[model samples]
Structure formats: structure tokens, C-alpha cells
Target: MLNLLGLDAVAESVYRGILDRPQDVDDLCDRLKLTEKEIRDALDRLSEMALVRPSTEDPGQLHAVSPHVGMEILLARQQAELASQKQRLEASRAAAAQLILEYDDRRADAGSAEAGVRYLEGIDSIRDHLAVLREQVVRELLTFAPGGPQTQANMSASRPLNQQLLERGVQMRTVYLDSIRSCTDTMKYVHWLTEHGCQVRTVPSLPNRMIIYDRKAAIIAAHTENTAAGAMQLTSQGAVTTLHALFESVWQSAEPVVRQARPTPGALNRQQAEALRLLAQGLTDEAIANRLGVSPRTARRIASGLMDVLDADSRFQAGVHAVQRGYLPSTPL
Candidate 1:
């Protein structure tokens, strides 16, 4: 929809009318059944987007650019913005990583939790902190739930809070692992979230478990494999802002949760591509399974299937064939 490209319904309708034939303000108002002011406002927006231009024959009139040209312009602009955001995200990730390393090195020497970071020990402590933050949220909540499929206990415990937030009209966006598609209970909970106005999406993997409240505070897992081990609550502006940017980058690239998560025609699915990447790096099945949040057996099955598709006799051969077939953009090695 044009809304995805930042065009509202009224503006799109006005552009369509103008595309049919060059139109003056009066003509657009008559054709669209909109008031003169509305038509003029749409024209102003369309003009700024370069979707509309002044008519050559009648300077007072405005004309629509061809649909192809207009759409290409919009797409190109969006692509550039996405690329810039990605760069910022990468920089933020690097900076955050370095800062965390530094903080960890000095924590014992300086004593107490470092500025901008609070160490939360145990699951209960993390949950209690989240409860307090939940009550304080005034706007949006962004989360990364990377484990393959959520546990029933966790989902059940979260529903009431989720419902209250939805009722209060706060925006909630969550990203989960793509492997969740294989879990009925997880899918059911995802459907419930969507039905109640929360947006959910899935990706092949996530960096860690995280929940950012209002983009001003965030809690990130201390251990990627065992989040319950501990967590760090971050409140520093620079760190929180960086994590917020990271979430936005991931969210924009993630696919919405649906009945099926399909790959593009003749291309590898995200999971398979990620597996191939890891395989190329010579990771063991257990390691790959850990990263993917899947069982070792499932990881082996996926690897075997990929080998069969590539007509490869070994994992190394599979990686080679994947590259030759353009399944991978060259091995990370």
C-alpha cells in the first residue's frame, strides 16, 4: 500500500485522480469528492514527494508522474534511508560492545554496578524490575525474544500484562525466532497478540533477548543461552538510544508473523541460509543448534537436507556448492 511509502489514503487518491488527467485544485476536489483544502493539501504533499509536478500547459494545474517513476523514486529513497540506518546500527552495536567490555573489566575495581547499567541477578529479580518498568511505559515497547519457541509458562505469565498494555493503547512490537513456526503453542500465543493489537515478527536469529521500554530504558540478557542466569538494565541515554536503533534495524528487516514463513522463489529460507553460513565457518551441529535455538537432531536434519540440495558429499562440500550456486554470498571464512 502507498501508506508503506509514507503516502496517506487521501494523498494517494488525489494522485490517482491527477494521474488520470492533469487537474487543477477545483477539478481534484470534484473528482475526489474532497474539500478544496483537502485536495490542495494532498497536492502539496505529492509535490514534495516528486509524485506530482506543475503542468507544462497550465502552470496552475498539477500532473502526476507516471506510476513507475513515482514508485521507483519512493523505493530508492526508502532504500537509502534503510542503508543509512543500517550503518548507524552497526556503529551503535560496535560502540555498545566495546563499552560493555570496558565496564566488565572495571566492574570489580570500581565496585557496584557501573553507571547506566544495573546487574539483575536471577529470573525473579529481572521479572520484578520488568514489572515496575511496564507500569511506567507511556508509549512503545520493543522486544527481542530469540529462543526458538516460548515456554507455555512464560506466555501464560505475560498475557495479563500484554492485555493491560493493549487496553491502554500502547504500541507493542516483538520479534521472535523464525523456528517458532514449528510450535503450535507459540503460534497460538502469537495469534492472540496480533488479535489484541500487538505487532509480531520473526527473523532467523537474534543477537540476544531484550526488551526496550519507551526507547529510554532496556534490559538485555546476560547470557545468550541462559537468559535466566542474569540481565543488565540499561538507562544511559547513549546506550538505550543505540539499542533502540538496533531494534529498529532488525524490526524493519524482519518478516511479519504468519501461517507460513516462506523464502523467495529458488532462494534458501532464512534458517537454511544461516545454517549454511555457520556450516561454512565449520561449527559443530550442537553449536549450530544452540545458535538457532533448535535441537541438535533438527539441526542435523537441516544440514543434511541442505547437503542433499547442494549435491554435496560433506559439510565442507556443501558450503562450496552453496557458493557456486549463489545460495550464499561467499562463505564468511
Candidate 2:
């Protein structure tokens, strides 16, 4: 291989001999025991590598280039190539670093003992991590959600994961605020969950949202003045266990949802029910519609209907009437 690259042992020996003194072809041939043709061939190869040059003193003789000079030229070419490669590598590394930083910002609270935190950057990443935890939740799954009903978007994201957990015989328990009982989408979800052998309960008020999986992992939203866009995952077993303990304490104080009393007929339509539920939770009509998978116009119409039924002039009054008339379940108030 070295010979294929314009170099060989014979060429090196010929170059070394020439370095001692300019040698005519006959002198080189006699000293190396090489035929004149062989000495000429070796010198030709060395000349091609720029390691030997024809002697100015004699047209038939050759002189070896100083090894230092030859090596300097080769090293400069190598250095230039390496510099180019380094520039490309640095550009690639910079782009990768920016991506990691952006992802870390989104998942800053999912602390890890590893060198880098395992970030759940997008909704897909969150789903994937949830799937892994669901698989590990052999014993139980617990949740406390105080916000409006799980949006259709959230339900769509979680359904497949919940099904997988159910298939693995994992036990599930969910506690929701009483407002969920009035949400058509939530009712649908709750019905599905019950059918899958999961237990569910309702409390009059919920302080925050939480999910604990197998006493191993917990997800909590940061306590910010602006609660949205501030969430974190906790993977410490001890901390997760404490959250689970809190969930159980709340669970014991909640009321079991009576499946028989679930509205079947003469209940509000899905959109209207979702609107009323969100309104009761103090969500604006726009946010309610966004969560309910409906248009804002439809949400406004629902709110209007609720007001008419409650014989109230404003949303606040309507909410008060609904609560008083048992439109919402009264549980552990």
C-alpha cells in the first residue's frame, strides 16, 4: 500500500544514498548492486514523490531533497485538510448544541442524575415517555386533575397509552374536580375509563394537576402566577411516593361517581355541557371552546343556553345557579 502511494523501500534506499552525495546512475547501480535500469526506476519513483531531484551539476545524476523540506510541505497540506474538517465539525456541533439548549428550556424540571436531563421536548416525546412509564406501572396509575376536562387533544394523546396500560393489567384511579361531571367530553372519557376497570372519584375542588405512576414518577406543573407553559416531571422515587401519598389522602376524601346518576337523556348536548363545565371552572368562553374541541361561536351559544336555563343574566350568576341546583355534583365541598 505504501508503495502504491508513490513510495517503496527501494525508492527510500535510493533517496537516502543520493542524500549523502549526488550520484551518477552508474555509481548508484554499483553501490546498491541494482542494475542500471533498477536504479533509474527507483530514482524515478522517488522523484515522483518530490523526495529526489535531478542534480544541476550532472544531467545523469540525482540529489535527494532535504527530508525536513519534504516533510514540511506534506505537513502543511495535512494541516490545511484538518482545519477544513474542524470547521465543518464545529458547525455541526453548534447546531446540535442549540437544539439541546432549546429542549432543555422546555423540560428544565425533569431533573436527572445522568450527565444530561432526559428532555420531553414535544408532545410526541411526552407520549413516548408516558408509554415507557405506563409499561413499568405494573401495580397502579393515579391522577389528580383540577383543571377543566381533559381536552379532546389530550384525550387523543393519552388514549392509546391508557389502553396499553389496561392490557397489562395495571390498576388505574383518577380523581377529578366536580366540574368534570358536567363536561360531556370528560363524561365520555370517564365512562371509557370505568369500562376498562379503572376507578374514578370527584371532589368539589382540586388545587392542581398531578399524575403518579407506580410510585416511581410524578408530573407536576410549576406553581407560577401563569400556570400554563410551566410543568415538570419528577423521577425521584421518594418524591413521587410523597405525591402519591397526597393523592391518596385526597382520594379518600372524594366522592365515588355514581354511574347510575350519569346523565343519559335530557342532558345538555356535548358542546353545551362542555361549555357549562368550563364556565363553572371560571374559564373564559374562548378557552372553553378551545378545550372542548368546538368553535368559539358554538361555545358562546352553549353559554347562552346555560344562562337561559338558570334564568340568570350573566355567566357568574349562571354558574352560581348551576351549583345551587345540583348541575354539578356536590362532593367533599
Candidate 3:
């Protein structure tokens, strides 16, 4: 049961045996029916993990650390490791973005464009490309509108094009953030779009904004923090197919906006569950906001609420409590 904390079967048995009563290697072997060698090995491993310490009064003796203290030590180690991993991931993202930019530059200098991947900068360029694609697309449109609520101007501007597409028998499906449920105008626009024969759904969060035209090409935000800065238009079969799969995966679990979705019994709601997962990943409120398409304040509130619910004093503690309560998987997802 304590395996998640780095304890194996023998180590856990040794821990339990010495928890309240410090046991020598002989006593442990006698109680656990293990060899003296196994008992000593478990003690050494436990000591290295800070779950057990040598007794000062008896040089050959070992005692288990308090359960609470041991757990805190293990949790702190996990949290540190998570923070390091998060840093590496951030660095990798930056590196990938740089490589894309360099590759695009090389293509531009060659005076010929690749057929598969192309980069477009500025809002006007993206809009122009979308307009051209809209006129040409014959089959379907799949989009992820990640930012929480649409602006009135954008909604008004999109209505005509959306109506035109729908009138031409295009299949349109969009997924938006669940936070839009609280925005009156956004909900009204969603209702209007639904009435116009578009299918719309909501999820707890989205990775980024994306639009796929006829499953042949996809446009994704070039900069996660500022979508207006640019976009990457991918026509590569492999990339487009992968994105389509991602959309389908999210769509299968998303709830339609026309009705409220019920949560599983004894489980956190999707939003809270997602928030806790992000919190455990060592994300800042701002980073959480970017993923969830909500303000940082909103992200902080959701995280704080989760901590309170778990009766945890810190983010890592919240994660530990969540695991203990079966709110999160023993192994991080």
C-alpha cells in the first residue's frame, strides 16, 4: 500500500514492524520470517529514504520515522522532482518553438514553401487564410475555441461565415472551455450557433486553440499565451491526422452545452479534478489559467478550493491527500 511512497513489500513490512517498536535485525527476521540479511537490507534501504533512522543510543539499532514525518519527506521529494520535470518540459517547448521558427526561416530564404507545414504571422494573415479555406472546404470543420468566452466582436464577425458554411452543408463541431457557462453573452452566442446547425461541446480545459478544415489541414496557435501573435498551418497528413485524433478523444468526453453534465458519484467535478491535477504538476496559477482559458485569479480560486476540500496546507500536501482519498491515482497520470 505504501509502494507509491517508494516502499516495496519487504520494506513496507519492515516499516510496519518497527513503526511503534524499534526492532533489531534479529527481531525483524523472527517476526517477518525473513533472513537476517533481508532484514538488514530493508533497514538500509529505509534509512536511505529517511523512513528509518539509526538509534543514537544503540549503534546497531534502527527505528521507523513517524508516519507523518516520513510521508512529508517523501512528498517533498516528489514535489521537487515534479518541479524539475516541469522546468525541463518548459525548456523543451521553447526549444521546439525555436526550431520551428528556424525551419520556417530557411524555407522562406529558399524562395519555395513546403507543402506540409507553413507558418503565418499576424491576425490578418490567419484570418485571410481561414477565409480562403472556408470557401474551399467541402466536408467538415473541427475547432477548439480554448479561451473562455468569445468576444462580442469576434462572435458577430463569425456569424456570417458560419451561416454560409452551414448553408453549404458543412459539418461543424467546436469545443469550448466550460468556464463560458457563466458568461451570458457567450452562452447566447453558443445557443445561436447551435440553432444554426453547429455542434458545440465544453470541456474542463483545452491545450490550445485549433481549427481543422476537412481533416486535411489544421491551424494551431503559434504562441500559447497570445494566439493573435501568429498561427501554424499544418497540411502534413501525419500532423493533421494526429490533431484529428486529439479532437475526437476530447469530444468523446466533452459535455454538450445544451445540458448540464453530471459528474461521477464520489468524484470531483471535471473542472476541480483538472485543477487538482495541474496543481500537482507544479504549475503556477498563470500557467493553469492558460490551459483552462480562465483568468489567473479564477485558477487560484479553484486551486485554493481544492486544497481546502482536501484539508491540505500546501499544494503537495493537497496532492498527497487527494491520493489518500482516492481523488487522484496513486501513480500520477
Candidate 4:
């Protein structure tokens, strides 16, 4: 139909009316119940589209072109346009890639005094950015996960990524809070990493949570006080060097987390000890529950009992008291 070919309804009707033969505007107007001017306008549009053509015998009359011919021409033109657009996009992609390379070269020449810094505003953004950096890991990766053990979900997400990095021959060294070793989830992930040739160690505390990629770039929590707010990528020589140095200093003093989960002779049971230990590592009760394979309620009960024994008013206080009493080992056992 002419309408499907981009003609108005009036144009479509006028074209259809004279498909078998040519008709002038006045005849089309009478057949379509339209004004002569409307018929002329319709015919003009149809003519422009090649849907209708002026008859060779009578220039005043119009007839429809065979769809096989008209539509084939339209479709061929559309295909050409699409191919042209694709080529333009391909050219733009190449230009963008070149720009990125040039920018990187400029940054390298500038040295560590300047930085390629960016802030990832939300958790999803932070993770996505980190994922990109992880993929680009060439030789080495260093991560410092402060506070405590990772949640089951976090551990699960990291499993395949860590596995892939190792598969690519990327050397990885992760530093965790010593308390993470007490959690089942962290233990599992650490064992998996060690098995796959990743070096993992733990410190009692870290100043910030960060990941350094090949000493060329580093990602650190943006908020010094509230690291959960967002993350920042540091690509300046000075900043990256500072972070790398921090990681190295800590790496030297931190103890290697033993993959072997051993029973501790202390005031708490293994599950309760692990839960309390994670609490000291800066994990919430929810995280504690995830690691202990217990319900949140159960984890809280264990924490509450420990708090009562320590006579502590807050979770942090409970952690310190537990450590002081040897309920949670602060050093590698």
C-alpha cells in the first residue's frame, strides 16, 4: 500500500484508485471524495516517492509504479544508508581508541606528579569500574580488604574473577584483616586463592581499603572516614607510589592467613568465636551470620552473649574486649 510506503491516506487512496490506469486530479478527487487540490497534493507526494508517476500518454493523469520496482529502489537506498552509518560508527570507534592511547601516553610522560583521578559515585559504579581495572591487570594485582571477612555474595562474585586472573598468569596478592580468617566464607575464598597460586596475607588493621594494579594505578575508597560511600581511582605517580608503599609495608608485617581452620581453646565455640572474630574485623552481624552459616538472630545471640561477658556497650567494645581476653586471636595461630 502507498501508505505503508510513507504516503498519507489520501495519497494512498489516490494511488490505489489508478493502479490499473492513469487518472487526472479531478477524476481522483471525485473518486476519493476529496477536493481537487487535495488530490493534486496527494498525487504530488506520491509522485515524489515514485509510488505514482505521470502517464507518458497524458501528463495530467497519474498511475502507480509497480511495487516490485518502486519498493526495491526504496529498500536498496535504505540499505546503502545503513551501510554508510555503520562505516561512520566504525571510524568513530577507531578515533576514540586513538584518543585514549594518546591520553595514556601524555599521562605517562607527565609522571607521578599528576594523576588520572576519578570518583565512582555509587556501589554499582565502583564495582563496574573495578571490574574494568581487574580485566586490564597485566602482571600484578594487590588488594587490601580492610575491616573484615567478605560476605558470601562478595566471595562468590570474586571467585571467578580471581580464578580468571590467575589463569592469565597475573600475580595476585591480597591482604585482609586478620579476623577474616575466622570466617568460613573468607577461609573458603582464601583456600581457593592459595590453591590457584595467589598470595594472601592478613594484618590486624589497615588504614584504608585499596587495590593496586601493576603499580600503574590504584583504587582506594574515596571517603577516608566512610569508605562505603564511594571509591576513587588514582593514577598519579605520587599517589600510586604512596599506596603501593603502604601495601608493601603492611605486607611485610602481616601474617599469612593459614588455610587450616583450627579449633581455638577459648571462651567461645568455633562458630561463636568466628562470629565474634568477624565482628572485631569490622563486619556487621549480618556479615557475621553469612560467614558462620547461621541465621542473623543466631549470630546476634552469640554476639550478645559475648557482649554480656565482656560487659561491653557496643560492638566495637565487644570486639576489643574479646581480643583482650584471647577469645579472638589477633595474630596468626
Candidate 5:
């Protein structure tokens, strides 16, 4: 039925009447109770779409074509259009791929030449390059992450890459915002990583999310602006070294996770104290969950409890309290 073709009710009726029996334009208009102009316009469109045909015997008579023939013609046109579209798509993809390759090669060449810095864009491209560097991590891995929307989102999406590094025995040391210590999902992921021998730590300071792999390659956010969503991967020895030094300076001041023990004496009841200790050390809620063998949400709740106890407004405040209480005497920032 013409209704099935998304035609209006009057148009469908006119089309069905004509298809059932060839109709003169006047009869089609009268039978369908439509104006002459409306019928004529519908018939013209149907004809153009190859859904209707003109009677050879009478110029004014019109007949609806077989649905099969209409479908065949429609399919043929669609196939042709799809083929053209595919060609264009392939051309575009090829051009984009070539541009990426050229950019990467040029970046490498520039690194060799000690030229100006290069920038990379998009999450997919960044992940792809990071996966390659992760494979090349032979000695050590260090990361600094400040909990924010973007960093958390990226970490969630980069699960496979993290698991891959763990499976390959890459030594990973990650520092995160003490605030993350309260996030349940982050804690579970941290537990997963630690179970596989990755060393994780926490610190109170807000260090931008950064990753240094094997002291030879480093990835850092280009700016503090949230508007930009890209990271810069530094491969040049000098740049990497500088980042490595910065990482180490922060790492040395970070609180190391004590994997072998639970909360120390009198720290259990004061969940805020424990939470403060963990945050000041830079453990995410996920890491805290794993460390405490608790659910991520529960770990976060405990952190919240700690916050309440300290009468502190933020994780940073709680961390400062822990330091003031001498929980972080050994690791001074």
C-alpha cells in the first residue's frame, strides 16, 4: 500500500486506486476526494520515484507499477548511491590515515632534530600511541593523576590498556589525588592492578595526570584548561628526563601504600584519620578499596565518614589534618 511507503492518507488512497485499476487523472482526484493539483503532484512524485507508470494507451491514465519492480529500481539506486558513498568514505579514511602517519613520522623526526614541540589530539589516537609505549616499558612506570572528570573518564576507558600492562609485568607506580581514594570503582580497579604487582601510591597535592614509562617516554597534559582534551607525549630524552625528575620529586614526597598491613592502632575507629592518611598519600578510592579489602563505594563512604569527623570540607583539608597529626611525618611535601 502507498501508506507503507510513507505516503499521506489521501495520496495512499489515490495510489491504491490507480494501482488497482488504471485511472484517468479526474477519476483519481474524485475517488480519492483530493484536489486536481494534489493528485497531479502525488502522481508526478510517484512517477518520478518509478513507483507508478503512465498508460501508453491514454496519456492522462496512470498505473501503479508492481511493488517488486518499484523495489528493484529503489534497490538499484540505493546500491549505486551506497557504492559511491563507500568510495568517498574510503578515500577520506585513507587521506586521514596518511595525515596521521605523516604527523607521527614528522614528530619523530622533529624529536631527533630538537625542534619545537608537537601536539597530539583525540582520545583514540592518544590511547593508540600509549599502548605502543606501554609495550616498550622495560624498567619502570610512573603516573600522576589529579582526580577530575576527564582523568576519571580516561582511566575508566583505558582499562584494557592497564590490564595489558599488568599482564606483561610492566612495573607501574601511579600517584593519584587523595580524593579518588573515596571513589569505589577506582578502588576496585586499583586492587586489580595491585594484585598483579603494580605499585600504587597517593599524595595530597594536585598533580596533573601524567604518565612516564621506562624513563624514556612521558605523557602529560598540555595545559590546565578543561576545554582542551588532549595530552602530549614526550619522547625526547631531555623532555622525558625533565618530566621524570618532576615525577620523582612528587613521587618521593608521596605516601607509599603499605600493602602488607591493615589500618594501624586507633586508626580504624577514626575512619577520617585513615581516609586522610590514604588521601595525603594519593590513593584513589579504588586503591583504598583494594587496600582495605572493601567495596569501592564502602571505601568512599568511609572516606566521607572521615571527612565528617575532621569537620573538613574537602579531601585536601582532611589530608592536611592527617599531615598535621603527624601521620605523614616520614613523607614531607
Candidate 6:
């Protein structure tokens, strides 16, 4: 009960023990079954609080003061300290809000600050700022995550944030490599996202990794050799329009991951048809792997398998035969 007034367990126990009877340090150690250091530390804190005192007959013996007097004084001091901290915290909060408002006002007035482009360096910074952007999204969030499915840890990090965004009633549409549906970790995330009102689609290849928040601000990753180099944030009308148009084109041809992508004839399997289309586009094996969400070796094996199925000796021959088989249209699109 004394803990509510700032007394810790050891201090409270020692005070109660002294109230039972005045005792020397050695007696306290024996009765409380505590180390001498612990008993002495408790006595020192209680003495400072005026909750304990030395016996007049033997200065080494400890005695408890009246709780009605001593504990009430301790409680009053603690309450005053808490009130002071609360006032300081409120002042800091007000100062921060005012500072941010003035900074934004000044930024809006600066001509150079109107460039509408922000270059962010480092993957961690990019992710950190993305969280900031997510909070500002109101109407919709459109994202294209190219290359492959995200790792489990990364997905876990954003899982709650994504769910919270949906709960805010923000419309979300995401695009990924068609192969994400086969990965256990990413597929699980995708399932959860869709269940919570996120619309998801997939394609054999996406032009780049991009996110457009309400079509107002667009962020594009600049990655090389599967490593994130940095990112670009574009807010100009021209840039946003161009990126949105590109997304629309891809979104049109992309397959819906679930609740969509029904079969169409002319007739290789969906995986083989996607592989053939990518090959016909002259994409390298590694690029194909990124598009297919598979390893480079697996991508090469897929290409080889397609070649055999078409009875072709080379990729060009495979493309030609695949077209004749109606797996791909004459125009690559």
C-alpha cells in the first residue's frame, strides 16, 4: 500500500519491520532474512524521508516514526513533484507544436523549397519516412513492390501499420510480382491485408518499386544489384500524373492475386505464359527472376523448361514458337 506513495517493496518492508520493534542492523538482517547491505540501504532511504530514526539510547538501532505524520509528508512531496513534471511536459508539447507550425509556414514561403522533390539517402531513413507518409494518407495508397516478396521480418514490421491504415478507412491497392502468391511468408501477409480491406494485384514484372500516397506524393526506390541505394520523393503535378498513368497501365494488365485472375485460353499455363512474355520482352535471366519472385537459377531453369516445351534451341526460337502457340501475342505490349 505504501508503494502508491513512492515506497518500494524493500523500503516498505524495512519500515514495517522497524514498526514491530526497534532493532539494530544485525537484528534486522536476521529477522528480515535480507543482506546487511539491503537492510542498510533501506534504512538510509527511510531516514532521508524522515520515516526512520536512530534510537536515543543506542544510535545504531533503528526506529520507525509515526506513519500518520511521516507517510503523509512523503505523499505530499511526491504529489508536488509529479505535478511539476506534468506541467513541464505540457510546456514541451506546446513548444513542439508551435515550432512545427512555424517551420511549415516558412517552408511553404521559400521558393526553392517548392521543388516538389525530396531525395532520401539510406534504407533505414527511407523506411522511417515512409511511416511518416503513411500517417498522412487519407484517401488512398497505391504501391508497387517489385523484385520479390518481402522478408518475413520486414512484413511483420508493417503488418500492424497496414492494418491500422485499413481501419482508418483508407483505400489501399498494392502490386507485387506474381510469384508472391507462392511464398509462404508474403502470401500470409497478403491474405491478411486483403481480409482487412487492401486490394492487391500481381504482374510478371513491375517497372520499379514505387508508392503513391493519395496520388499526391510518390516515393520511388533506387536500388542496384538487389541493394537499396536510396529513394526519391516526387510531388510535382507532372511527376505524379506520369507515375499514376504508368501505374494505371500496369494495373490494367496485372492479375488480381485472389478473387480474380480466372483462366483465359490460347493456352499455356499461367506461370509458363508469364515466363514466355517476359522472355519475349528481352529481359535477362536475373531480371526475369526478379519479375517472377524466384532465384536467378530457378528463372534460368524456367526459361530452359519453356524452350524444351516449345522444342526450341534458343530463347529467340522459343519466343517465335511461343507466339505461334498463342502463348504470346505478336506485339509484346
Best by lDDT: 1
Better of 2 and 4 by lDDT: 4
Q: TM-score of every model?
A: 0.68, 0.43, 0.67, 0.46, 0.43, 0.61
Per-prediction tally of clashes: 0, 0, 0, 2, 15, 0
Model 1, 79-197: lDDT tens digits are 21111233343454466556555443232123434567778878999889899999999899999998788898989999999999999989999999878877989989998999999
In candidate 1, stretches whose alpha carbon ends up further than 4 angstroms from where it belongs are 1-114, 259-262, 331-333
Give per-model CA RMSD: 11.1, 31.0, 16.5, 28.1, 25.9, 26.3
lDDT (Cα, tens digit) per residue for candidate 5, span 230-302: 6666666766676676666555544554321222333323234444555666889986665444558977898
What would the per-residue lDDT of candidate 3 be over residues 172-243, giving only the tens digit for each residue? 999999889779899999999999999999877776778999999888877777889888777778777767
Worst 10 residues of 3 by lDDT: 79-88
Candidate 4, pairs of clashing residues? 112-237, 147-281
Residue 196 displacement (Å), model 6: 0.9
Q: Cα lDDT for residue 68, model 5?
A: 79
How many backbone overlaps does candidate 1 show?
A: 0
Candidate 3, pairs of clashing residues: none
Off by over 4 Å in 3: 1-112
Q: Which ten residues in a row have the lowest lDDT in candidate 1?
A: 78-87
Which is the better candidate, 3 or 5, if ranked by TM-score? 3
Q: What TM-score, to 2 decimals, does candidate 6 have?
A: 0.61
The global Cα lDDT (0 to 1) of model 3 is 0.77
- Candidate 3 at residue 28, lDDT? 84
Model 5 misplacement above 4 A: 1-113, 148-156, 258-333
lDDT-better candidate, 3 vs 4: 3
Candidate 1 has an lDDT of 0.78
Per lDDT, what order, best first? 1, 3, 6, 4, 2, 5
Candidate 4 — number of clashing residue pairs? Answer: 2
Q: State residue 200's C-alpha deviation in candidate 2, in Å.
A: 0.9
| Candidate 6 structure lDDT | 0.72
